[model samples]
Target: MSFVGKKYKLDKSENFDEYMKELGVGLVTRKMGNSLSPTVEVTLEGDTYTLTTTSTFKTSAISFKLGVEFDEETLDGRNVKSIITLDGNKLTQEQKGDKPTTIVREFTDNELITTLTIGNVKCVRVYKAV
Candidate 1:
């Protein structure tokens, strides 16, 4: 039913480097991001949700409520205002900053698929439950 309490490990990524480039990420950071496999854990507590992404480089934990806007510092070191909305099994996030982007995460068949859209670039990342 819910995607909470599950841990998903990054399986593969498509066009991730291009997407990071669109976000103005530097060469070194892009290479680091591309080389690392991150594990994402989603936890729900009433109306609040925590999404934790952990990798060899770093771990990022974000906590927010549905429809509430919060400040976020992206992995690439960009600060933005982000809001996440849940629709059925899909969670969509809009980050407002100098370079706005949209992220959509959908859970299906025990897989969490994420789509990142920035300008004309789109990247898909697949994660499998672990």
Candidate 2:
């Protein structure tokens, strides 16, 4: 279950606007974020895992190792410390900074679902393998 080389295309999104708003993303960025469907891919080099997100608007990437904390600049332009870990079929990440959030990516046979949560707001985005 290396997940390397697998590509998934965004198929559905729920409450994404609220999640972005919770992360302090401005209206224009949020709107741009909502308008496009991004393709996400996971790749590995040595012990480092890189998750890349690409859309017509912008492309973003984050590379990290399991259980190791790294400085991350989020798509919303926040500098946060993030660490990721794997549990069964899910890869979970906890980000700490001005607006803390948790992101979980669960893998299944046909789809990959990413859940982003902060406080009382939770957003789910589903990606189908492509």
Candidate 3:
């Protein structure tokens, strides 16, 4: 098994806060982000892999292989499902039936960068091991 794990302390930056708010996340989630200590784990087994996120507010698991489509509800419970494709070390995901929502992920310098896009709005969250 090839895996990388990191615990990140999150500060609800203005951009992220605004984005989540716009997505209709409740006040609790917004408050949770302020005091969130999230752990992210990535495991790679051949072309199939799993990514997990755990925190006080939410826990989510995603499993996919390269160039596969998976239906996933957004954190806000929106019906934005995506198909993920790996391009080298970066991941590109586009909503299957919705063109307005997209996500991209990249790992570098022991940090994980994830960008979420909804329509014309884009929000980025950065995490590093504690």
Candidate 4:
């Protein structure tokens, strides 16, 4: 089955606070981000993919095509130029701004493993199918 059309709930996270700090997220937003468990839903329509991240604090959605650059407002409130690419069951997103970042989501074993990299700090967030 394709990795699309599945809903996943956040199970656990590692080093997320430190990663957020590296991204220059404010204390309040970082605290709320660390405490919130979000559900992510991915949907595919032709060449476009829609990703929705829902949490108690906020819900954000973005739709984009692979390899195409788009303007995106990140959860930490940074406006970035982003591009996403798909390799096998993994989706890698590169966000360009003052501090460039890469986010990779790998789908396997009914779980979604997300790795966030900013400078030398890295965070891993695991989500299980819900």
Q: What is the TM-score of each candidate against the true structure?
A: 0.97, 0.96, 0.78, 0.97
Over 4 Å off in model 1, which ranges?
A: none
Which stretches of model 3 miss by more than 4 angstroms? 1-14, 96-99
RMSD of each: 0.8, 0.9, 3.0, 0.9
lDDT of 1 at 93: 96
lDDT per model vs. reference: 0.94, 0.92, 0.68, 0.94
lDDT tens per residue, model 4, 29-50: 8888999999999998898899
Model 1 compared with the native: what TM-score?
Answer: 0.97
Ranking by lDDT: 4, 1, 2, 3
Q: Provide the lDDT at 117 for model 1.
A: 98
lDDT of 1 by residue, 1-130 (tens): 4679989999999999999999888999999999999999889889999999999999999999999999999988889999999999999999999999999999886899999999999999999998
Report the lDDT of model 1 for residue 85: 97
Which of the two, 3 or 4, has more TM-score?
A: 4
